[model samples]
Target: MTKTIKTVSFAAAAILVVIICTFLIIRQTHENVLSKETVVKKVEASYEGKVTKATQSKDKKTYDITLENPKGTYFVKADAISADILSMNRVKAVNPSAMTEKEAEHLALERVPGTVKKQTRQSQVATYTIQKEDGKTYEVKVDMQAKTVLSADQISSKDQQKTPITKKEAKTIAERKTGGTADDADLEESEGTLIFEVDVDLPDNKEATVKINAYTGKVANIVYED
Candidate 1:
């Protein structure tokens, strides 16, 4: 009887040890799990909001954040570092949640139809940077919610606008006025208006710019390089 009691006690001690080891392993795993609540708390510290809403990407990549106010909502870029954007740089006003990426790409291609160099989300807009065959780069903004291209502009200069006068016409007019041939012609924005600007090289080795009104199709201004 004494031997049996001793054997039973030894078996109980071994079982208890196994149970404690398993519990420790499970606790470690739980501690290692990524917590959304922790990330939200971190963001709330920076943005000064209650973080009323929070979401993770489908692949468990990044988090999308929303405050109590509708306008106070923001998005987090999905990745390892996980950065949230309160405001996007150089982005225009547009509707978010307009369309899918594929739809935006298709719309951009239909509108610009050039080399699709880059695609990114700016603020809430689907922004695409395209390079043309003529070596000109343009930025196209698509409002996914509105399902339309909001604006297209040359990346370098907001100083240009669409003109009714064609490039060929502008060049011809510039050459006739300056007695020179066109080096190049482009529609550019000057001041608050759009103008057709033609660069001409004269026989006197002078370079001149002829500006034509985009709407009126008349000579607007000219500047000669000194």
Candidate 2:
């Protein structure tokens, strides 16, 4: 009976040793896992472009990177541990026959008969967010090459009431807040609130988009662009 007990004890010790060794190896491997910066560098080196954005997956197993170059915009997925690219795809390229921003704005106004509130443009995809006089916001998608309005959808309609602040007052408030030159201003509704969207130009070639509350004349948000 004593000899059998000794053999069983030895087997249990060996199993515990194996488990401890496995745990140590895993800990070291986790410590050596690649970082997001290293993965971005590896992709930029291999892909030859400027990295616009890099994001890690929720599982922390892979990375999604956006790169922009003269060739176009590319989306690349790479392994987190080995920094190996799993897939690559070009998402956008410049369209030679695409309509200019001014052209799109003009066409959109002709179709919708409102002030241009915002512009969503990426490569060949162009859209104008417009606000009509009746407090209804419409999104107008235009054909890139054909210069025609593809679709116009009413996104939101605010309660109809006379805005307390005039358009000129909103422009003055935006310029005062930004200390820049106000180029254009438009009154629009955002999330059931009346607001003014103003474009301003700074001194050093920087631009700003300012949103002011139309009722109270308060600046809501400002976004700067290079």
Candidate 3:
């Protein structure tokens, strides 16, 4: 082949490789997500409406849901991308006072130090958590109508030793114990003791707090929320 043709062929091959790598990364990063049916059911239950139109994204990882109720029609898209993060995005035509997750984070950070671990809305209130450096987690509730914080309380934190079990392994153990998914898992110090507290959400809508000894990798205690 001539020099110019060879150069063109090499460039094309490089571009093809880059595209393939991008696709593979996206696939590997988001291999699992909440099902559309499951999301629809949750939305319907929360909105007390019928999902008249539901559309899954072309990538099959997210959803656009239309819910019709006595009040009016509302639109919400569920984001199902990256690190199995399940959250609603770009909500519209519903409650105007409700804040997006990003907005909620901004509000929380203004009054607190640490990182938002998880956010969920229920009963028209957005509840979230922030993990602080002192091995404490704070649960904050924001009112949907007023867009203000309703309450902030330090719920759990523990003194955790760099130890026998990784947080991932501890989460797996919690899941196995509760038959539920784990979130807001943490390791911290409490006085002189170290431990891991994992919030496991059970399949039946129940939540359990599992405490694991950081050094022993054993269940220190288990408590279910009422």
Task: Judge candidate 1 at residue 58 and give its lDDT.
Answer: 71
Candidate number with the higher TM-score (1 or 2): 2
**Alpha-carbon lDDT, every model:** 0.71, 0.84, 0.74
Candidate 1 stretches greater than 4 Å from native: 1-163
- After the best TM-score superposition of candidate 2, give how far the Cα of residue 14 lies from its true spot, in angstroms: 2.6
- TM-score-best of 2 and 3: 2
Query: Over the stretch 79-151, how does candidate 2's per-residue lDDT look in tens digits?
Result: 9889999999999985556688888889888889998866777766588878899978788888768778989
In the range 105-202, model 3's lDDT, one tens digit per residue, is: 78877777788766767876887777788768787888766789889887733422332456887898888888899996798876676788999998
Ranking by lDDT: 2, 3, 1
Model 1: per-residue Cα lDDT over 1-226, one tens digit each: 9999999999999999999999998777555545677767666676644666677667554666655333444444323134444432222233355588889888988888788766778665898877778877688999887899998887653322332446776788888888988999888888877788889998889899989876556787889996
Candidate 2 global CA lDDT score: 0.84
Q: List the residue pairs that clash in candidate 2.
A: none
Clashes of each: 5, 0, 8
Model 1 weakest lDDT span, ten residues long: 86-95
